[model samples]
Target: MNYKDPSLPTAARVDDLVARMTLREKAGLLFHTIWFAPPPGAETAESMIDGRHMNHFNVLGGGSPREMAEWHNALQERAAATRLGIPVTFSTDPRHSFSSNPGASMMAGAFSQWPEPPGLAAIGSAELVRKFADIARREYVAVGIRVALHPQIDLVTEPRWSRANGTFGQDAELTSRLVRAYILGFQGERLGPGGVACMTKHFPGGGPQKDGEDPHFAHGREQVYPGGRFEHHLKPFEAAFDAGTSQIMPYYGMPVGTEHEEVGFGFNKGVITGLLRERYSFDGIVCTDWGLITDAFIMGQEMPARAWGVEHLTPAERMLKAIEAGVDQFGGEACPDLLVELVEDGRISTARLDESVRRVLREKFTLGLFDAPFVDPDAAEEVVGRADFARAGFEAQTASLTLLKNGPLPLADGARVYVEGVDADVAAGYGKVVATPEEADVAVVRLAAPYEHRPGAFEAFFHSGSLAFPAAEIDRITRLQATVPTVVDVYLERPAVFPEIAEGAVAVVADYGASDRALLDVLFGRAEPQGRLPYELPRSMAAVEASPSDVPGGTADPLYPFGHGLTS
Candidate 1:
C-alpha cells in the first residue's frame, strides 16, 4: 500500500510492490499480450484487462480518440479495483502512416497523419523529428497509451527489407542522430508523468536479412552478416542508450555465420545477455518480438510460432531460454500459468522471477501510473489530432517528396493534363484533364513498385520478395512516355529496381507516403522536395542480388546512391 505514496522513489515503490506480490502476480508482469479492438457494444475489454490479470497490452485496432480514451480509463478503473492495484500500460506499433498492416503498424485513424519514419529521415531535421515525437507523445498520453513500440532504428542496409518504412535510412550516423531525437521526444528529459516511454527496437539492428526477407515467417528467419558488419549495426542502439530509452526489443531473425549463437536474438544469450546486457549495459526491460512462444491466428490465417532456430523447444523451454537470454517480457503472448508452472515445478528459480518483476514494476512506478493511472477523456477529445498537429504532418509529407528528375517541372498552368493514380478532381484544379496520354500536353502517373506477392491477408500486407517491376508495367510506362511528357511518382516503401522508369519518365518523383495534394504541390513547385534517398536504388535486380545484405551501398553501381535527390 505504501507503493501508492507519491513521495516515495520509484525504486522504493518497485521494491514494495515486488515484495507484496505472490508468484502468480509476478508471473503476470512478464507478459505483454495483444488486444484487438472489439466492435462497438462488445463486452471484451473487462475480461482481458481484469479477468486475465494482464497489466500490459499491445493495442491492435482502435476507434475514435474519445472512444479509445474512455475504453482505456474503463480498463484502468477495473485494474485499480483489483488486489495490489497495478495500472495497465498500453503499447502500439507506429500508427501515423498510410500503411494498415495490423501486425506491423496501424492506419492513421483520427490521429495526425505523418509520413512514416523514412519520411522523417528524408526531412533530415532533428528538430522536426523531436517535434513529431512530442506531438505523438501528447496524442498517445491523452488516450492512455504509455509505451511506443517504435522508432525502429534499424539501418536500411538491405534495401529489399519489408520493414524499411520504419527506419531512419541506411546511414548509421543519420539513424543515430534521429534515434537520439526520437527518444528525447517520447521519454522527454526524464520518464515520469506525461512521458510516453519509447521501446527502441530490433536491438543490434534487424536489417541485413538474407535476400531482404522479414523474420515473421520461416522463409525469412535467417539474418546474415556476410560483409562482417555486425558491430556496425549496433551504432544507433548505442545512441539510443545515450538518449536513455526505456526498453529494447530484439529481432526474431536468427544470426547466420556470426560469432553469436545461430538462434533468434530473443533467445540468443550471447547477443541479448553478452552484447546488450553486459557490453552495452542496457538494464532496461527486454521484450521479445511478437509471437515467439506460441502460434496464433491473425486475420483468419494460421501462423506458426516465430521461434526461428528454437522451434524444437517446448513453450516452457522457449520461455526459459528467453529468460536465460535476459528477456524481461514476452510480446503478443500471455502465459502466466506456464510461468507459474515453471516456478512451482522448480524448473525456474524464484530469484529469476524477482529480477524481471522488479524491472516491470519499476517502469510502472516511474511512469507515475500508481499515482495517476487515469486520463481525462474530455481533454483527450480536444488534444488528439488537433488542426495544428495535422497541418505539421501534412507539411512533412509534402517535404518528403524526393525528386529524381524535374523535366520541365512546375508545368505551365492551364496546360491540358492527363493523370492516373492521382485524383482526377484534384488534377483538374491544376489544368484541363484529358482522357488519354495522346490528348494531353503532359501525362501524370503514380505507381507502387512491384513485389512478388505473398499469400494470406496478413502476409500480403508485408510487401516482401523481389524488388523488380514486371515487364508489362514497365512497358506501359514507356508507351505512355512516348505519346507525351509523363511525370511519374512511385511509392517507395522498399528500394525498387526501376531503371526503366527512371529513363522513360520525363519527370520522376519518389514519395514514402503522401496525399494526392502533397505530391501535386511538389510537382507544381508549391512545396520543395526536401528528401534524399534513404537507401541505394540499385541499377538492377542483378545488382541487388549480387550485393551483400549487411553492407550499406553494396551494389557495384546503384542507379541512385544514398542521399541522392534533385531540386526543381
Candidate 2:
C-alpha cells in the first residue's frame, strides 16, 4: 500500500498499490462524475432538490467558481478517505463553448470561449490549436478538472451528425496533424505538474455515423465501414497515440456488419484489446463512451436499454464485458457498484482490476497530483477568459468564414446593408444594418437549424430520425430575396439545404461559427474566403434518405461537395 516508495519505479509502484486495492476503490477510479456544488442555501435543508447532487453524467446544473472549487476539494477529500487515497480525477465535457447538447453545457463564464474546433481548424494554425489547448489547460487546472474530455479529432466527413461541431473537419491529413498538436498542447511533454491530461475521443474516428445521427440513441447505433475504408478513421487516432494521449474514449456506435468487431467498440475485445492494444501498442487508459454501462434516458424519458448488438446482456453484464475487453475506465458512467459486484461474483478477475488500476494510477502519478494536489484559487481569474483568448476566437471566426458566391454586385463600403435571422446585436456590427430585411440595399440572412429540446417527445423527435425546417421561416427568407440581392449564410450543423433560397439569392455562404465581424469582413472583401466545405451539403432530405443509414459513401451529386468554396 506504500505507493510513494521511491525504491520501486513509478509503474511498478502503481502496480503494487493497485494489487492491494479493494474492488470498490478500483471501480471508483473507473467512474467519474461532473462535480457541481449545491445551490446557495440548498445544502442545509433536509430535502434535496433535483440538481443538488454530483450527477457524474452531465453538467452540475451551474456553480460559481468558489462553489466549484469547494465541491472539487470535497470530492478529492472523499477520495483521500478511501483505503488507497486514490484521488478522484474529475472530468468535463467541453466547458469552453456553446455547441452540441447544451443540457450538458458548462458555462464559459470563467473559461475562455474559443471558437469551436471547426473554426479553429479553419484558422489552420497548429500553434494556435496548441495555444488554445494550453489556455484551456490553465483554466481547467484552476477549476480542479484533471481530465479534459475533449479535442474530439473525428473528421467532419458526415454533415448530418449533430456533434460535428466538435470535429476539426473532413480532411484526414489535416485532422491527423491537428490532433497531434492538440494532444501535445493539452497534455504537455509529460503528464505531471501544470498539465491537464487530454482524453482524445471516439476512436477510429466517429465521423462516419450512419445518416449523421449520434449513436446515443438506439436507432443511430449502427456504424458502417463500407469499401472497408474503416482504416481511414484510424489515422488521426494513430497520430494521437503517437503524440502521447493519456486516454482514449470509444464511441457509442458499433461496427455492426463491418469487418471489425460486432459489438460496440468499448465492449469489443477485438477493437479495444486486439487492435488498439495489441496491434497499435497503445498503453494508455481506454474509457467507454458516456453511459455505455446502463440504460440511457433521453430528456427524462427512459428508453429500453440497448446493448448495441449484444441484446442478451444486462447493464451489469456489459460492464464486466467492457472491463474484460480492455476498457480501463467508464466516461460519465453511473454504476461503479456494478463493477464492484462483478468483481465479487468473479465475473471480472482481480488481475484485470489490477491491470486497469495500475494504468489509472500511472496517469495520476504522471500528472504529479501527489506533489501538488490543490490548484491556486487566486490564479483562477487571471488564467481564464483573457483578452488574448477572445482575440484568438475572433481571428479563428474570421478564418472560418467561407464565401460561397459573388454576383454582378459587390458589397461597397458604407453601403446600406440589412441583416436578418441572427440576434440584432450580433448583426448590427456588420454595417448600417436594419431591423427588417426590406430596409437595406442588400440583405444578409443568417440561419441555423433548430436543435431538439427536452420538452419535445424524444422518440418522435430524435429516435425516429427525421430533420425538419420551419416552412414559415423558409418563406420569409424567400420573400426577402425578391426585393434585394440577398446573400444567405447557413450555419449548416445538420445540413438544412434551403433550395428555395439557394435559387433566389445572388450568393450563398456556409460556415460553422462565424462571428458578426467575420461575417461582415468576408462580405466587404476585407478577408478572402479560404475555408472549404468540410462535408458535402446534401441537396435534400431525399438525397440523404436515398443513402443507406449504415453505409455513407458513393455520392458525388451533393448541393455542394466537400472542399467546394467559392471566393468573391
Candidate 3:
C-alpha cells in the first residue's frame, strides 16, 4: 500500500491510510484512554487493541525503566501483528517531579526528580526551562513515552486553585518568554521522529475558577472572569502554539459570563472551534481533559465525569457534543463503541471522523512509530535516572529553594537540632540531631502548604479550597516556634496563607519540591537559596477570598509578594 511507503509525504500517507481504515479502526483513533499501568505483557491491553482497534494509551503508573521499555516493546509487537500494524502512542503526565498529585502529575519513583513547575516558574529562566525539557525528553524517549501531557501553559492567576503547582505561574509575559524555549527543547525546531510531542494543556486559560474551586468536580463548574483579563491569559498559549506544540488539551472549566458559551471548553464550540481553532490557528490535535464522557474510579473511589454545563446530557450525547466542539480525541476514556454507534446512526459523519483520524495518524507517522516502534531495554536501563541527569536535577532542586525570611540561617556545624517532618539521618549531616526542642539549640520544621481535606481518596489528590492553615495546626506550629529559634520550610504547592509562620519562625523558607538533603544544603551554607515566590502568599483567607480569581497579586495585604526572596 502507498500508506506503508516512508518515501511518501505525510499528508498523502495519512490520506491513503484513512481511506483504507475500517469504521472500528477509525472510531478507535478518536479515543485516547488510560492504560492504568498494567503488567509488562498484559494480554488485556493486547486483546483490546486487536478487538477494539485502539492504539493510544496514557502511562498512569510507575515501574522500573527496563520494565517500562519491555512493556512498550510487547505492546508494539502486538500492534505489528494487527491487520494495519499501527504503533501504540504512549503518553504520561509529568513524572519528573517530587509532588505526586495523580490529578496533575505523578511521582518520580525511578525517574530523575526535579522541582515542580512552580519551582521552574520561581526561577523564571527560559534557558533553564529549555534544559529541563531537554532532559525530560531524553528520559521519556528512553522508556517509549512519545507524548507529554504537559507544559501545562495554564496561567497561575488563581492562587488558590489546586493545579497551579503544575503550571507556569501568574505572569503572562514570563510564561510567554519561557514557553517557546520549552517547546523547542521538547520537540526541537519541529516535531519529528524520536521527539516527544508536547500537549500544551487547559486551552484558553483554566485559571479564574469561582471561589478558587477546581472544575474537576461538579460543585466547581463555573470559571468566571470578573477581572476581564481573558485576553491576558491567552498570551502563554499563543506562544505555545507558535512554538509548534503537537497537541492541545482544553480544561474542564466552563467559562461563565464571557462571550463564549457557559459549557466547558471541551464542549463549548465558540471556545474550541472559534477561539483555539480559528483565532489562534492551532491545527494540532485537540483532545479533551480526562473523563469528559464517562465516570472514573481513581484511588478506589467513584468519580463523576467533568461534564460541567452538559451534565444533563447522557454520556453518548456528551461524546457527540465534544466531537462537534472540534475535539479530535476523548482523553481518559475507552468507549469507541458509542462513537461507532453515533456514526452508524448517522449522527456523526464519516468525513468528520476521517478529519480527526487524519490528525491522529499523521502524528503517529511523524513520530516514526509506524517504521520503528520498538525500544532497547538495556538503553532504557542505562539512560534513565543516570548520574549526570540526577545531578542536574539535584542542582535544580537546590537552586529553586526560596528563602522567604533569612533569620539565623547558614547555621554553624555541630549545633544541636530538633527536627520535625524531616529524616534524622539526613539532618544529622548539618547538625547534631536532638530528640527534643529543650535539648536542642535550634529547631528545623518542614511543613506542606495547607489544603482543605475533601471527602474521598481520589479527591484528596487535588489540594484545593482553603489555603489558610487550620487554627489548631497554626497554634501547634506557634508553640513549636516558642520552643527554640525555629527554621521553617514550607512546601508551596500553590500560593498559601501563612503570615503567622512567616512572623513566628526565626527563618522561613519556601520550596516547591525538595529533599531533606536539598533543604539542609540551603539551611546550612552549602548551597545558596536563589528562588523567588511564583505568586503572592496572601496574608489571610479573608485576603484570598476577597481578591478576584481572574486577577494576579491584588490581595488586601500579601504576606509575601511575587519575586520576594532572600539569600543567607
TM-score of each: 0.98, 0.87, 0.98
- Please give the lDDT score at residue 37 for candidate 2: 45
lDDT of each: 0.88, 0.68, 0.89
Error of 3 at 469 (Å): 1.3
Please estimate how well model 3 matches the true structure, expressed as its whole-model Cα lDDT.
0.89
Q: Put down candidate 3 lDDT per residue, 1-568, tens digits, no spaces.
A: 9988999999999999988899999998878888876553456766569878999998889689999999889888988889998889999999998878777789998888999988887888889989989988999999899999988877777788888888878878888888889889999998998799999988888888888788888888899888888888888998998899999999999998889889989999999999988998888999999999988788898888889898899999999999899999999889999999999999999999988999999999999998889899999999899989999889889989999997687998889999999999998888899999999889999999888899988888888888889999899989988988899999999888888877999999999998999999988889998898888888988888888788878688789998899977
In candidate 3, position 41 carries an lDDT of 43
Q: Where is model 3 poorest over a 10-residue stretch in terms of lDDT?
A: 38-47
Off by over 4 Å in 2: 5-9, 34-67, 81-83, 100-107, 296-298, 303-306, 408-414, 426-430, 449-473, 524-529, 546-554
How do the residues 185-223 of candidate 2 rate in per-residue lDDT, one tens digit apiece? Answer: 888877766787888888867777776666767767878
Could you give the candidate ranking by lDDT, starting with the highest?
A: 3, 1, 2
Indicate the residue-level lDDT of 393 in model 3: 87
Q: How far is candidate 1 from the true structure (C-alpha RMSD, Å)?
A: 1.3
Clashes of 2: 4
Which residues of candidate 3, in runs, are more than 4 Å off?
Answer: 40-43
- How many Å off is the CA of 73 in candidate 3? 0.4
